[model samples]
Target: MVNPRSSSSYRLRRSRFVVPPTIYRLALILLAFSVFLFLVSQRQIPVFDRGPSLPQKSSELEERLWDSASGYGYRPCVKPTHKYAGIQKSTGATDHMFSPIENPKSERSSATAKYFLCAFVLMSYTLYCRFSPIFNFLLASSHYICDMVAVARLMNATLIIPQLDKRSFWQDTSTFSDIFDESHFIKALENDVHIVSELPKEMESAPRVRKHFTSWSSASYYEGMSQMWKDYEVIHVPKSDSRLANNDLPVDIQRLRCRAMYYALRFSNPIESLGKKLVERLKSHGPYIALHLRYEKDMLAFTGCTYGLTDIEAGELKILRENTNHWKMKGINSTEQRLGGFCPLTPKEVGVFLHSMGYPSSTWIYIAAGDIYGGETYLSDLRSQFPNLVSKVHTESLATVEELKEFAKHATQTAAIDYIVSIESDVFIPSYTGNMARAVEGHRRFLGHRKTINPDRKGLVKLFDMLEKGELKEDTKFSSLVIDMHKHRQGAPRKRYGSLPGSKGRDRFRTEESFYENPFPECICPTDHH
Candidate 1:
């Protein structure tokens, strides 16, 4: 090549030609015509030969959807019918509540402009001639939006929204917030299920939904609960407005029963199979202590042992000797197996520990341990080392699964909590989870069921002390439970509490020590604390 640089220069020089001005002008005209045509044919507001009335039955863009979804033959798009079915039973509460005027002024204004602009564009393009592709698309979209909005307005929906504050919802309360988060208003809509919005009052916090009413399909159930609350407000709206009274809608009696069940089953999911097992094996009796020792990964990944080790690990062999002292031989089958003394205990060991703690361990000691059967041998060995005092202990494995379903659920945090309160006569002395503690408090509040629970006071005291040090209220809500724990032991046993071994936490983690007594050591009682 003559010279690479020179050759490149020649190519650049040759490429510098410009189009003629006449040709440029023609191109601009063509572009403008295409844009103008597109805008005209898209979503144009029809220049109806008639006055500004609702667009008539056919030719008008709006009529296409009405025609399609109005009568029996309108099943193809599934949208308009969905909308119509939703608003069918409404008493106009939803329509007024969520009326366009209720939206923020800015949003309403913008939507109005957008609708007008789209209509203008359609009119501009279609006024001239056939713009088949554009016109068809615009018609389909209009049908979809209009049909959906119409359903929400008419309250003819097969479904009902109990929680969401459609523009018509009149009140605001904490209870309403709970209803909104806990309710299934959005999910029903997404699934194309039609529900009317009729519970317009703010006080109507709890919601109930009706599903697939048009098809006479099975009725939809409220997601969480259906209990008759002791303190609940029952609102019996008119049949026309209440999904509960919708005779045409299918009813789910099983769903009705589910809501009224004794315990909240949310805790029973990932732990369902296990929950069933516990349900089957559970023996209700006096109070029991639930000890959950988070182990394993805490040993390795926990930068430097987050929760800390018991004397079993800190002092090693020496603490193992200490653990040996408290090992109550369990007569009942315990899934007990120790990990290391200070480390996490095995599920069986946990069972054994509860057994050794007081009377019967088979009573519900809901634990959320990562490894239920993981460290069985170590725990059993410790139990074996001291067979006398511990031999009467009984522990039934409360949580065990081949594969974890819900990490938190399997943790048994909630169940461990309510386990104590549900046994109103009993108490739980758990070594972990104030969330479970708060949950117990909440469950008691909801159930209007209260129990005297004295959890591991030694440790709880330290925590509360820390809270106080940090300037936090000792008992955010359940502070009443905490008193001078040493004060009253009227019916409590003085002996058993003293002889019982302290927590496995040795020098690794310091805990206040107070040996509590067991009134009914052979059995279990709320008054007992070992």
Candidate 2:
């Protein structure tokens, strides 16, 4: 009952659609057969495929760039880049990528194989798309070529990263990752500090900052660390097991990781921005002493420090008994009191003793320390005792470690020893650090020219011993307590010799005049006094 015209139109539409599809199928099969016949006919295309292309030379500008960063030497602080390219498979650094130097030789073959396998998987998926422009861009951005190039560049030397520099190392993201992952970034840092047992004469002669970054084979150390991964047959410290899903690093490695965390997190303050406030705290045309106090947990746990006592107590603990079976309480004539208030001091008791020394009130004091509350009460007593020299010791006076680190940025930091020695002070003294082999060299460099006494050895032996027993705790805070208490009760002076004020800058808190050593009848205060 359908109209003949409508039925005819439907049949024509179906025929047109069916005929085009069939024709397309037939054409596709014919095209494939023809391509096979063509391949068989022409086995090879004749082009200039005789030899590899000539290698490209690096530009003078590129050479200059590398040279300038390397301090104008053939030996750059950076390692050769080629060693890790096989694993990285990129011409540049990659995201969270690590050098596979954890294993060497055949041991690392499995890892090397895995890298290629990943590349193969990716390549197979994109076989048809490999020649597309979009595909090339993605590959470039993916870091495979860049990483491979970086590894190839590293072939000249085992090293792969840059040296320690505040400005250069942090400027660009690419350079940063390349330099950062070359080795255990923090591997140079050590608890034993025994790496440079026999320092060269050049190092011994260096002063201040120059010594800190001194060239200790400056050639070898960098190269050794760079090649460590490639040469090591297996891991040196330990490896992460499957137990930890998130973190596989062992304890020692975890500790090493903390340094990087600290470096990254550390704040750098501007010289004028924050220094203005700190300088404002100081008085003009007067003797001001800086008392650095550290009460952090790390400072409090040191055994080499003391429990607080007078110099007399330090000199003669058993003899003070006066031969009486019960020789008891004779108020300590503190070492600080012994100084007659000539020098500046630290911690609660040292501050108190300084206050007592300036009883009539002579010098203004700046108390710098952490965990200010730890010494708040003692500082209060000091303020009450000497109100003059003890004018400004308080929680507010303590600069945070953050502040010090910030200051270090503005401050062309030298060795602590050098700074102490450079001061034309009546005395120069440091409590917990400085004057170690590394610091001594710097101190000699900066302060040696000035002839300041760099007494960084104040607690070296004790600090090391404590560090060995895994007891490097409460260092500065404990030392402060002991030193302060000794000054208050024993009348022990800080140091007989120290530099004068205004040697470095008016706002600067270090000087020889502020130095002190307990001057009991005995040469040094006894090592073990609870």
Q: Give the per-residue lDDT digits (tens) of candidate 2, residues 1-530.
A: 99999999999999887767889999999999999998865555321121111122334322311121221111101111233322233343221122343335674666754653453333210000011111111111112212212222222111122212234211222222222222233243222011111223333332211111111111223223333333221111111111111122222222222222212111122322344344444535243444343322222221112234344434443343233332243343434232333112234444333322221234455433333333544456556544543212133453345655533322122112112222322222223332121122222222221111222222333443464487754333434433343332211222223345556642232332111121111111222421
User: What TM-score should be assigned to candidate 1?
Assistant: 0.27
- My TM-score estimates for the predictions, one after another, are 0.27, 0.27
Those runs of model 2 whose alpha carbons end farther than 4 Å from true positions after fitting are 1-272, 283-285, 295-297, 304-360, 385-429, 434-530
Candidate 2, after superposition: displacement of residue 40 in Å? Answer: 99
What are the RMSD figures for all models against the true structure? Answer: 35.6, 38.0
Deviation in Å, model 2, residue 286 alpha carbon: 2.6
lDDT of 1 by residue, 1-530 (tens): 38999999888886896668999999999999999997776446443221132323334433221111221211111112111212111233322111121234587646743553343232210000011111111112212222222232222122233222222111222121221222333333432333333433543554333222221111333211112111232322211111121122211221111121122122223223443444444334223333333433322121122222354453442333334433333121111111112223333333323332222323434333334222544445434433321100133244343322233321223232234323232333333323233234333323322332333434343444455487544221223333233224112222222222454633211232111111112212122222
